[model samples]
Target: MKKNRRRNKTKAKLTTYGEFLILLPLCHKEHQTELLEQLKSAKRPAFILGKEVPATLNTITYGQLDDFSRINQEKEDPAVKVFSILMGLSQEEVYKLNVFDVFGVINFVRSELDRINKLFASIKVAHSPEEIAAGVENLNFGTFGVIDWYAKRMGITNQDDVYSVAWIRIYTCMKNDNEKAEYEQRLNKQYVEKAKRKR
Candidate 1:
């Protein structure tokens, strides 16, 4: 039993560490090595003030990412946003972190942002002006667009457990249905295409 628990902790830690490694160069080529060394030296993927951090961020939904992008326009609080939304922690949990951990998180996030900002800075987004704007009357707002789908699919209910459903489970259901449909409406379009080509 003890061996199993130890193995699980190591697995979770590696998974979490890998997540950071995958998201990096979040800054410059120089900082990439620096960040890698930092994560390597740190006891990551678990215990910010002895509170176990989740191994994976599968709980986060696409909808939450959309909200994060919109609300964090200035990119002022990457640590808070990541800790809360990605980690699935509450605002109060942010208070539990020490100043050192918080600083490390901020550095990691800012490095990524710096890399992104530099890449996109010179690229001009061209917008063609619209001649005619569609009216609200033209838009059809369904009474149960989302509800009608999930009701038949996930057996989703108005309950606490319903909210706790992982996004991957929902996405898997959709992509599996897509596979059954001969890739007519792929939720994971790129993956489906690439995997098909391999066959």
Candidate 2:
């Protein structure tokens, strides 16, 4: 019984470490090698991002890569537009992110989702509302990381202020889907009116 428990614990640790390694993104070329070396020297469970799995020439997970074989799609413009509110760094900050810094993470997540199976790809990766919900849940986890990163990078000084704005925008978006859609449609209508006047 004790031996079985030990084996199960080891298996659980390995799985978590494996999944964590799969999800990490290395920022630099040398970071990968450095990570592997550090993991080896410490003789501890660790994951490397942006780096090949140690002792294996095969890069990329076969299962995750094969997920891209299915059809890819896009989401509603309004959904994406409103989603971007939570997705992007606020313009009010003193340390504005560079274009690359701002969009780089977004693009990387897109590409990563592209590699996943069709059933589990991304926001657009989902065709049904239920599927979209699941994908959005996964996407939200990623977005939350970005918001936290921004807070750290900007020296937010007040966690409540940052979190409050995030919750407000998220609540507004989710509170009334129909109303939000109508609001966006109204904005588009006004834009069209302005364009017609210009013509």
Candidate 3:
């Protein structure tokens, strides 16, 4: 009976420690300072319940803080590169973006790159004119979709800017005569619509 009780007590203490770790990341810097102080004050009593709780929690919290800073630093440069290349922004402009905005831009570019890669793969294996046409259509759709998404995300309503940033040169590399003409027509229509909106 005593052994069972001791085991259950240890389990409960571990559960509490787990909860503390989970919530630690959600705390603001100021709140985290307060939490650290509280943990220090509670450590003596916590040792009575379980010797591991307070020391383990402190070590984990400090490790998480270091990791958080390191991750943000690591992500910054790659995020800036993606923004600069895809959006045609200068490095200085990319550097001005906040961490959250940088992350959003990186995610958008990564997903769009995946989509474009898949479209290219489909185009490569196309056996007939019809299959090629279908692939071209899919590719065009994804291209324009990405441009539209970027326009919205960056608040760029200017059609010219959007076109300049578009991967049209890369997109046209594998196109046939008919597919190229079709894509040109779509772009012209989009330009016309954008001009009308400006008026």
Candidate 4:
């Protein structure tokens, strides 16, 4: 009985998605300060029950948060990068998308989509949940398990839903075809300029 009890106690240290979801509202300035103080007071490496953990909205700056809000507020049109990720389109494909088209289901509902996008940016992307490619931790949608964990906590069972939101946000910031082309052009110009200088 004692061993089982101890095991149960240890399990509690691990967090769930609902715990993380709660942090969205708590990321406010006043709430954040309080949470930070609480975390500082605790100081333990392991997660504290309902207190210290990634779900605790104590670390983000207001600017980072505001950016997240804007991202969420934007319409999820085909022109939006998130839509591309949700649809599993390549960056090249996303780059060619015109915002003019009003397609079916391309646009997300205002409020609910905002809530979902804000969470992805503020928590999953910012928190380092999953890695997209090896040695590319900072890449968008990189935190795979973290997203899953968040969904589970919030009782969001649809894996596709979670992945779609995450992918879209990450895709927005991703280097699309135009950006890649521009970069490559710049590099080529630089190389030619360097060669002329050498001569």
Candidate 5:
């Protein structure tokens, strides 16, 4: 009887479809801010619970981009919040999802975020390999920021049209804007330094 009681219980794995359904995360401003903040905050080093340990471990998952529960918003992992936004699943859906499926959901969200990070790889921001890669951290803000950037630079007043464009196109415009800004900054600094030398 004791052995039977102690037996390990088995659970079913996540179900499969023809292909995973993945879409760009919500483009709303508030959603974007929440999503970005979740990813940003997830960077804090994890610690062993109820134990003294150094909090120096830095973990970065591929290409280094980085979520759930309603039980308590304060104590819940950031991923929980992100899942609701990125997966379009409500807290109830998540609560009912299988443990294995939860991981699948988390990975799906990360992949989408990873795709966003790849955009920063070739931008004109950083010089060294490390520096360029560091843009991943800097550019993780939500889509609202990107849209605002395009509007400010391209003089786009038609809000509907702007919002309808594909996320990649919007991101490309942002990349171009960043490159241009860096170039102008470099040019101005050179002139300023030259003037100082002549003084």
Candidate 6:
């Protein structure tokens, strides 16, 4: 029983170390060689398994390369519009993101979407109209729009700030979908009035 437990612990540690090695290449290229050397020096105990361990790290290396290629390919994909909408970034800014930074932003947006979806799901499951109303009131919608409006009013036009402002406005409207149509109509009217004044 003790031997079995020891073997299991060793297997878990090896699996963790293997996963770390697999992800090391995703780091900046300048650090890749040093990381690889460190990985090589981290020795794992060889225990008998049904299959022979591969002699080379070629498979893991290829997987990292494939991920890099996929990220580059995705830059041209129409689905990137979703990221732009979520993050309030322009397509041009999104295209400029480093692959790792893009991955991080994508993950952040995905998690936020999941949280928002769950909130709506809870609102749907409420038993009474009052409960639903309470849920809706508690929902943190429109805060991003307020922030964006304030930022733009203050004339903060730097690229990052501009994107953030846009993102907040879009994200707020998306979360408040029932009001978005009316909100857009109001925005169009405002734009038209501004254009008329300019004429």
Each candidate's lDDT (Cα)? 0.48, 0.38, 0.46, 0.40, 0.46, 0.44
> What lDDT would candidate 6 get against the real structure?
0.44
TM-score of each: 0.39, 0.18, 0.29, 0.19, 0.40, 0.26
lDDT of 1: 0.48
Q: Residues 69-148, candidate 2, lDDT per residue (tens digit)?
A: 22244632221222133233222220232222223333443444444323232222223477577775555554345346
What is the Cα-based TM-score of model 2?
Answer: 0.18
Preferred candidate (lDDT higher): 1 or 6: 1
Once superposed on the true structure, which residue ranges of model 2 sit more than 4 Å away at CA?
Answer: 1-88, 117-199
Runs off by more than 4 Å, candidate 1: 1-45, 59-71, 86-100, 103-148, 155-163, 183-199
Q: Specify the highest-TM-score model's number.
A: 5
Model 6 spans with C-alpha error above 4 angstroms:
1-79, 125-199
| Ranking of predictions according to TM-score | 5, 1, 3, 6, 4, 2
What is the alpha-carbon lDDT for the whole of candidate 4? 0.40
Which parts of model 3 have CA positions greater than 4 angstroms off? 1-76, 126-199
Instruction: Please tell me which model should have the higher TM-score, number 2 or number 3.
Output: 3
Model 2: lowest-lDDT 10 consecutive positions: 44-53
Better of 1 and 2 by lDDT: 1
What shift in Å separates residue 149 of candidate 2 from its native position after superposition?
33
Tell me the tens digit of each residue's lDDT in model 5 across 21-115.
Answer: 12114245664464334333332222212222223212222111212212244776444565444444455555554433454445554555555
lDDT of 6 at 107: 45
Error of 5 at 165 (Å): 5.1
For model 3, residues 98-189, the per-residue Cα lDDT tens digits are 33334444454445456655654654423357767677645555545545655675687864465554243333444443476567768997
Q: After superposition, how far is residue 65 of candidate 4 from its true place, in Å?
A: 16
Error of 6 at 60 (Å): 39
